[model samples]
Target chain A: MGDIQAIAKQFTDFYYSTFDSNRSALQAVYRPTSMLTWEGSPILGATDITEKLVSLPFEKVQHKVTTFDAQPSSPTIASILVSVTGLLLVDDSPNPLQFSQIFHLIPDAGSYYVYNDVFRLNYG
Target chain B: MGDIQAIAKQFTDFYYSTFDSNRSALQAVYRPTSMLTWEGSPILGATDITEKLVSLPFEKVQHKVTTFDAQPSSPTIASILVSVTGLLLVDDSPNPLQFSQIFHLIPDAGSYYVYNDVFRLNYG
Candidate 1:
């Protein structure tokens, strides 16, 4: 549990930092078989999902994680759920959007990667 | 979209109110087919999940939703994802526990119900 906690914290820090600055760097965190759900629409493959991330309308974004929790799904898998309230500066919308995100991380080669991810904005 | 948003808000209001006061009232929101994942463990069926909820260590709880997002999964199904940061006053702890919860709501008759729910505390 201690190891899991440390890894979850480190991965979350790295993940969101890259998301805000260098989204392309996230390639190392996802593989070809990774699955992503944006809002409720499903997008498959790491390449496609990263492309969508880069194409998002927000030019400047900052994620403030309010709550972070991790649980071991199996001997080798850990699912980390994070609740975040973030600021997203978009074109049409001047107000920063708040959202929540969850990621299921899997271990490989002494590191962790995202296997399943779901993200949604906190609005109607 | 408008209808879905209204129902999601109403359901959330009612659900948490019952959760804080009369947990037994939540029985009407979940069916036998309902599924719940608490922390990392899975509990099947409505009766079992309600039992677990009622038996939780916390004596008083309150959920303050920071973000509420809903998406239509199908013509007849809607998935609502909520990000919450709330306080839980337990017996052994002086400070309230903060947590986040996500609920996947499905439509039945003219109302919505929790089909799949996942909850976890925001701590290591």
Candidate 2:
């Protein structure tokens, strides 16, 4: 069994750090079948997701995770579900916006790839 | 291929309606392996989940879905991912709170069970 807490912490740290510094490189964690629902808009495939992330209008952004939980899913499958609630700072904005993100990870070789991702800003 | 949009809409409607009307009945959709992260607290199994939900302090609550998206995941394994952003009213509070939820559903005996669920209130 995978240590879900440790995995959640490590993955969230790496994911946000990469997202803050180099959004394009974040594509390394996603596979060709990966799908992302960005604020209710669907973006499929690794290439499209990467493009969508890279094309975000904000020049600078930071994610501060307030809470997160992860669970090992499907007894026969090596998969994990992670849910994160955080505050996002865009363009050095003083007021951070609340955000929610869910990521489904599946083992590939010795590592993992994101199979599904969903992101939304809480306060419109 | 499953109709993700239609499924999400139907599921959300049923879920919230059941949640508001009869919290205990919601257990019919969850199994022993199911896990829920409620406001950062972990609750496992249908029985425990129902107990926790029923024990909530609020007597009345309403959910207004602002936006939702869903996707079919893992070609080999049939599963669906649904993410929702909504406003929640608790105890007839005039101020509605922002909320986020993600549910992973798996097929069993022609219907689906909640395998993993995550919920959080956006504001502190």
- Fnat of all models, as shown: 0.00, 0.71
| Docking band of candidate 2 | medium
The value of fnat for model 1 is 0.00
Where model 2 places Cα greater than 4 Å from the true spot, the runs are: none
Give the candidate number with the greatest TM-score.
2
lDDT for model 2: 0.87
Kindly list the per-residue Cα lDDT of model 1 for residues A31-116, writing each as its tens digit.
87676778666777789988988988767776667556554433223444333334444545657665557765766786777766
lDDT by residue (A18-120, candidate 2, tens digit) is 9999999998998888999898788888999999999999999999998888888667877888889889999967999888998988887988889989898
Residue pairs with backbone atoms closer than 3 Å in model 2 (clashes): none
Error of 1 at A98 (Å): 1.8
Clashing residue pairs in candidate 1 (N, C-alpha, C atoms within 3 angstroms): none
Ten residues in a row with the worst lDDT in model 1 chain B? B70-79
Candidate 2 lDDT by residue in tens digits, B1-124: 3476777678889999999889999999899989998987889999999999999999998889987878886687667888888998899688998888988888888888899888988875
